[model samples]
Target: MKKQFLTLAILSTPLVANADNEAVGTPLTAPPEIAAVFAGSAGTARTAEAYDVSPAELDRAIATFTNGMPGDSAQWAVALKKSFTAFEANHPHTFGAALGAFLFNNYLVYHDLPLDDAADAGMKSVIAQYDRLVREHPEDYAAADKEKYINMIMAGSYAAMVLHGHHQDKSLAGQYAFLKSAAGSALENYFKVPVDRVVLENGQLIAR
Candidate 1:
């Protein structure tokens, strides 16, 4: 009986994973620099020497971002681009911070947020961010690995949209499937072990 129960538990595990993805996905906690970068975007740009925003304002912004569900993907995409751009411009020395911010924001919009708009800009940003990373820093292994993960998320979401009959255009579904397959193949080639799932808690992308 114990062995039979163990088999049932093993069989039930996939269901729980799927449920976790849809309901309460994984939460990504960022480091201090990345969190500061996000806060700077919402509050004020930090100086070369230090972050110089009003503590109250920054705190409030952080609360709103961390507490609220993203309303629109395109809007979040634009905000992310703006924030990352600002971070890079202000703190060129802390290059990795910008990347961290990008990854966090992208995951939020790409997966956790609702897909209300079909405009290409949101998806395009995902591709563009990765492209920029590889173009600017080809030798960085982290950038390459991140690109694979981004592609996987894109492909998986698109495939889900089609598989669950969410698309109005079958042709578009086919296109997304192709993109998904391409991303999957690239990810398999690039990373020995890739991230199998991505989950974000509400307001997880926004940081204080």
Candidate 2:
């Protein structure tokens, strides 16, 4: 009877992960210089060095964002994406891409929070952040390389999402494997630049 119960428990398991836990996989915690770079973007949440924008202003912007959204998961995802796009572009860096990825995953999480194996949500979060980096930072990354990175991550995410919808995949480990390999390739291409070109001997950042 115990053996039969165990088998039933295993078979009854749902999606193994959920969207709320999905993150860009880039440590959100950043150094001050990088924080400054992040603070320069428009739609980004306040970083360590973020400018003193009033909370009232932020609340107003958020209200504007959710006011017209349709009540659906996919639509909420679209709304979040659009919200990220519309935020003030004060920050010069695309670090928020990572945060946006997290939020996007959370949006997915809201729909499938009850599922036990929503690993696709986590995978999409990482992919979203990677896409943000590739889309926003072209100078540090070659256009061809950037395109390659976006394609790889997006493809992985879509594939994972499909598997989740099918309910056939018992584990989503393969998606993460693909992301890591793709990220390594992207890193290699991104670092093919002269160190001096991206940094100054004076300890300043490289400019576009």
Clashes of each: 1, 16
Reference-based TM-score of each model? 0.23, 0.23
What are the runs in model 1 whose C-alpha is more than 4 Å off? 1-166, 186-191, 194-208
Tens-digit lDDT string for candidate 2 (1-208): 0000000000100111112222112223333533332332233322222223344543444344346544554553443333333332312223333333322333232232222433334433443454454345433222122222122222223322433433455365554344333333222223232222222112111212
**lDDT by residue for model 1 (1-208), tens:** 0000000000000001112221111122334532332222222212121223343543344344334434565553344334323433433222222222333333432332333343223333433343344334433322222222222222233233332332445555654444344333322222222423342223221111
What's the lDDT for all of these models?
A: 0.29, 0.30
- Native RMSD of candidate 2 (Å): 17.6
Superposed by TM-score, candidate 2 places the C-alpha of residue 6 at a distance from the truth, in angstroms, of 39
Q: In terms of TM-score, which candidate is strongest?
A: 1
